[model samples]
Target: MAVTLRPEIAALPPYRQGRAADAAAFKLSSNENPRPTHPAILAAIAESHLNRYPEGAATALRTRLAERAGVSIDEVHVGAGSSSILYQLVQAAAGPGDEVVYAWRSFEAYPLMVTVAGATSVQVPNLPGGHHDLDAMAAAITDRTRVVVVCTPNNPTSTSVTAAQFSAFMAKVPATVLVILDEAYYEFDVDPQRVDGLTEIANYPNLVVLRTFSKAFGLAGLRVGWVVGASYILDAARSAAIPLAVTEPAQRSALTALDIETELLAGVDELIERRARVFAGLTAAGWTVPEPHGNFVWFAAGDQTSAVAEVLEEDGIIGRVFAGEGIRISIGEEGSVDPLLGSAARVVQTLPKAGENARLG
Candidate 1:
């Protein structure tokens, strides 16, 4: 007989990643920085000592992140990736019978992590404009709510929560409940009114902000990320983390990325420009996409998502598609712009409802 497993765990689907493209196709499915990794970062990774185990506490890197974030060393925690940090924090703050709240159609990993922690998930659906309904999320919180995740420039949508809206949302949250602001795309955000987690952290004792080198730093392959929060809360996450999961090479690469952040940010500036181009191009083509503050654009294709995605694939453009919901196309290489726009225009011509006149459910 098969070994018995928890019914919830058994029924849960494995996390699905963005589709990968073959040769001749632009892999715009994942929101990866299309820019090549900096030479300095590559050199730093090459210098890592493979003979010994990595520092379990990730002291050197944590020190660098803490200093940069203006937090005490104890308040900064590093993990394999920001997703890993999220998992650690979720497991640390919640367990069976507790509720972990976040916006629906947000990060795909949020529910999985909550389930893995044996906690209940409370997902408030996004508004028609693809922004979080902060008031509803706050209202969903109960005495059993142990954690609330706020993802800015939410994955798959690229819509952000403004600073004013976030402040109002925080006012309704109980002081005892932990709040995690997942800012994996923080470096790519261009909106002046967007929620600034680094600055907001000081106002809320229960708040933690998560960021990753995976996007703007072009270090997705290195898999390094960090969180800033109260020392004791971060200590709890650190306690649950897999020891030394932040490998030496990843640590070295992150340190070097920080050192050359000026150059990396210059590259990010280019992607930001590309994002603007993508937005304008899509809009002019009759597609109604939300103003993308992150590195990707969202197409609310509704029932036409798969058909539209197939059209993109035919034109050598591969974007992340959510069946019956929408498509998220990342801002990729300069060469991808024309094909992406071409495919999008075709979709608009063939299905007008997926464009400017579309009604979102």
Candidate 2:
């Protein structure tokens, strides 16, 4: 006899992560905020109990998040990270034999998470401009569809579908299907129009908005994220969540971080500027990069993405290479980006002065 795991689980692709370690690594594979956590948050977490059980209800953190999010405390649900709660959302909201639709190349996690819940995934292909094709996504939905994920400023692509488009899609889509808007990199932008979809959730009962402290708050290691929804939907997630999934220190840190939102957003301003600088820098360097509203940049360099990444990795600056599809590089702290920029300059300088035939890898 032999032991075997679920075929779908065994067949699932591994979750891709940003490289965050190395002596000289400015490893920006993960879309992490380069800024360190707020000192107040650090102090609060340190002062909190190490052995006590975290509030299973996550009441205080929920209250703070609700105040900041302009929603009721009951409308908020905290998790170890938005990613974790999203996993729970899929399981609780969707089921086997159901289909989950999302944009291909959106968040790499959507498909895997959907499959883990025993649902099939339908990833609508990206539009020509690298944005999610909401029209196609909405049309792809069928009665069997249970949830649809919309990752704005979509993960590897670093592009977003506009609010108008999202509104149109939301209008036509059946209210029975849950629409999860995963805004993992929400705080690092100045584009009011594109990211303003947060408030739009109020109108749709099926809306589930996901956010995290991992980006602007620099709390990736702490893993604090939450869901904003109608009290009914959030209550469902609350009841379904693994008991006390959030740690006390992480919740305390998230609360302290919320109190200093202004300072944190100010740092976000600098990060946005640096992202623009890097975008301009790449464009001036004669590359075909996309306009990104997130904290990172991606370009369609064909096979050269791997080449650029290899040269960067050799220089001890690890970047994410999508192989033939393209490459994504993140904007971190000033000191962090300096080394990355240096390596990038060399990778660009040494490559063939022409097409994607040049292999820097």
Best by TM-score: 1
Q: Give Cα-based local distance difference scores for all models.
A: 0.91, 0.79
Residue pairs clashing, model 2: 18-29, 18-30, 307-361
213 Cα displacement, candidate 2 (Å)? 0.9
Model 1 C-alpha lDDT versus the unseen true structure = 0.91
Off by over 4 Å in 1: 356-361
Candidate 2: deviation at residue 187, Å?
Answer: 1.3
* Residue-level error in angstroms, candidate 2, position 227: 1.1
Query: Where does the lowest 10-residue lDDT sum fall in candidate 1?
Result: 352-361
Candidate 2 lDDT over residue span 10-45, tens digit each: 877798686666776676778778776678988988
Clashes of each: 0, 3
lDDT of 1 at 260: 88
- lDDT string for model 1 (100-170, tens) is 99998898899999999999999999998688989999999999999999999899899998899999999
lDDT of 1 at 203: 99
How far off is residue 177 in model 2, in Å? 1.0
